[model samples]
Target: MPYMGDPTVSIILPTYNRLAYLREAAASVFVQTYDDWEMIIADDGSSEETRAYLRAIADPRVTVLWLSHTGIPSIARNKAIGRARGRYLAFLDSDDQWRPAKLAVQLDALRVSPDCRWSYTAVDLIDADGHPVDRDGLAPWVPYAGDITERLLWIHAHIAIDAVIAERRLVLEAGGFDERQRFGEDYDLYIRLAMRSPVKVVDAPLAVVRAGNGENYSANRIEAYEGWVQLYQKHSATLPGKRLRAIARSRRAENLLILARLYTNAGQSWAALRTLLLGIPGSLLTYPPWAWRAAKEVVRACFKATQRRI
Candidate 1:
């Protein structure tokens, strides 16, 4: 199966006020080895600079869409998915750029595994200057291959947005990304997708993820963890009652640990204690050991926070 239709891929990019990196991101898409694709970048509440920059792009395959501020990434993604008309959909973050052959390689992977409805490739961690975050090694995702669902359940979180490519119909069936979700919507969508269908790995680093200090989104870890809690709650009912309950407990425990760490980082001892108290119910002995380990880290973070001047 080479490709299903006239255009094999629809690269869906959701952006906010990230004009500084938008051009590079767009340039990466235009340079793809595979030509049968369209790039749909939906801007959610951006400044005039972004609008002008988007207009400056002359490629016929690249189109810009502007909409009001939704304050949620999922909403912006939903807007892009609505206008997409390709057999396969790939998501790219605004602040991230893909490798030159990213789309081409991933699309070929899908072609080989036509039965796989969802797939992701590896990614490199880069800094604000677009340099590698680690010179000695790649991120922990490169080794991922074969049956991913069972491995994903305990192997941490979302593999990053840039590496994902899925059949358009499968994405629609999974209800798309939950626009109502404010944080971790990417994880929400990915987990649901894994539960529904098997996932394939391209086994290549297809994108560069900008990761560094003082970042706007990554700094807000507590909020992102809270959003993860909401996601599990929202989807628990969709599966068997027993599995839902188990996952819910695990998600809650994980969330509580994050809240504790956040309070510790803020140098609020009492706040950290409260956060731990919240974790107790979810961190019961019945839950996984990872939650317990996270609980200990939170405790240390709280103490370290107290040693600092307030």
Candidate 2:
């Protein structure tokens, strides 16, 4: 049955060419225990089959926006957000899914904590075939609550966008996602939002994230690291206190060093050298040991290349 009046929550789902995964994700939304919700699916020029499936959605509460392929999730999600009419906003990627009680639990948390404008839940990591993957080495699940801006800045919180439910106005106040960022856009938005309001947490894992899927955009390590560097540069100065600023600088330097190592491993010696040099100022100001580690990476690459010829 078609729902009447405005929904309490609006789900912003962005998709590319993953139709198989899209079906499962969309179905998860349809099966949610909470029914007074709408889903806005932003399709970034998917194939005809995907388009057909979207168009066949008979649910009046669902809206599909078609855009020319930008290959940018931020653009698609921002468009969907602009069209949202609900009081609260939720996010779900095309490859992820939510448990039936996801919305109910998060909504209850926000209701009890009237001061909080956002809430997030833990997530279960799954493989492409939907099999559970061990979270052994991944960031430990922490039930973070209240003002988490510093935690986000320090990269201590593992808040996943797909597991989040935030007030629509707060999301708009944060200016939505940065369109220029190809990756880590969610982290950037979360930091901005956390600065404005405290957040609640649903301790249970109610979201399922498809991990180690090579088809996902964030699977590209170089681009992901570059995105983090851009975020640090953009927000470092705005961070309050000298301690936070120093942490930002150190994190930026670490990302640059990681990128440098990646370039060295790929045999791009000149690029590696340039990246290492770029990180030097931050390393000197914050963590000087990273400078030596980056230098070693460059030297090791050169030595390996020489040994190969001999």
Candidate 3:
């Protein structure tokens, strides 16, 4: 179906070297029940084959921008956002796909809740082969809507990047994606957006996310840790009230425990121990369950002999 008049949503797709999955991602958009949408594919210096694949796309609604290889996805997304001419902006990473009703349902939800400018849906995880991976994909807290900022600060929600759709002004107001962030860019943007306005959720899994692909940015322990630290430092001061601040501290402690696990996985037992120690004190007050689990995991892993771990 051809798009008529102006599009309601501008889909920002930033790609690196993931050519194999790019076509599938675009196909998902083409099948959307909502016809009024534009997809901007930002080619961040992919190979000639990937470039050719993008150039072959004949859809007028799909605009492809070729740029020099900039390792940051936020830069490519920013370029797309600059060129977008839509009331709402949605993100679809190169390696992810969405359900046909994703746009229509989200748009309807936002229409009913006029005050909520942003919304995200649950997600399904797929393996490298595009096969369904029945892991604990969604967050424990589901179907959360209206004023979820406090809940966001404390727990990890299943809001996938491609699953989100937000008003153009709100996204820009949140300063767009942090260009300097090599990781956790989405987390930072969503947190900031929630701080300003209430965000809603679609409740159902409307997105298919590719995880454990080995090529993903989250695989980098050091960069992931840096991103967590950056998040803590950036948002810690803005949290209102002592309770929220304590929750923020617990979140930081949780991140440290994750870092400790990463260290333990890499056979850096002493480093893991040090990281766990740093988090232990705050974990007791903010969230004891995560703290205890982290401690047990870190200790168990620290005892293992040094070996190359994935």
Candidate 4:
């Protein structure tokens, strides 16, 4: 089935004080092979320079919504979505740039897989200097198709928001982005989308994600983990079957283990021990041996420390 209508892909960009990078990002969009697109930039409390830069852009396809600094990307994103007129929607962060063929390839894939309402391409990680980082041969994503709700919830794979494009209606049906989530908001939205339909994947790397660019909205690991916990609480009840719920529990346990490690590294021994104990039951339910192994590792570390003191 051939795609119909204007074929305009609305690019939703939410930015805050990243003027230099935003210019590069917008340039990438302008150079896209698929040119029938509108770039809606939601300025979330940027400085005068940023606003002036946006105002100076002469392109008629570009639209800017100057909003008060809400400190929430989701809020900015939702505002852009409200004003979007394109049949398809794509997201690009201010600090990320796409290959010229990025939109073209994703749009082609979606056209081919008409049943798949949304799709994502693989991404290459670039350092602050914009050079590709070597990943020791690990792909950005594990390839999978069809209903990926359980797989996503279990954290077996991930879809980068910057690498994705979706039918506008489907995104709206997924409730855009959750405003309440300060971190992992994209992850929460992705889960809801996967639950609705099977997501398609474009195997090619078509986007460049700027790593460590100093505009790190997701810099707080602890708060990010807490957001994940909140997502589990929000969606676990809606998931189907005992197995899916079990996976959710295991994921929770895994996050707790991570939190405990963070605490241990920061010299909060008592808190680490308590968190580890809290995680034990769920860990045993998921993989009993892992709980035992983690306990043994903790004991060994404690024993080694005591011996050094003696």
- Which number leads on lDDT? 2
Instruction: Give the TM-scores of the predictions, in the order they appear.
Output: 0.82, 0.95, 0.83, 0.85
Q: Candidate 4 lDDT, tens digit per residue, 68-162? A: 99899999999999999899999999999999999998899888888899888788888777888778766447777778888788766667789
The lDDT ranking, best first, is 2, 3, 4, 1
Ten consecutive residues with minimal summed lDDT in candidate 4?
1-10
The predicted structure with the larger TM-score, 2 or 4, is 2
Model 1, 1-310: lDDT tens per residue? 3434557788899888787787788888888887898888898878888888887877777767888987677787888888888999999888888998987888777778867787888788888888878756543554555455434545453488888998888899989988778787777777678767778887777888888735546467767766766765565445545755576657666666666677677676677677667666546663767555765866687668657755
Please give the lDDT score at residue 33 for candidate 2.
94
Query: Best candidate per TM-score, number?
Result: 2
Cα lDDT tens digits for candidate 3, 199-229: 8788888888998788786888767886885
Pairs with steric clashes in candidate 1:
none
**Model 1 regions lying over 4 Å from their true place:** 1-6, 135-139, 145-147, 235-237, 241-248, 264-285, 288-310
Cα lDDT computed for each candidate against the true fold:
0.75, 0.89, 0.83, 0.82
Alpha-carbon lDDT of model 1: 0.75
Error of 3 at 202 (Å): 1.4
lDDT of 2 by residue, 69-174 (tens): 9999999999999999999999999999999999999999899999999999999999999999997887787787898877887788998889999999999999
Per-model C-alpha RMSD: 4.4, 1.7, 4.2, 4.4
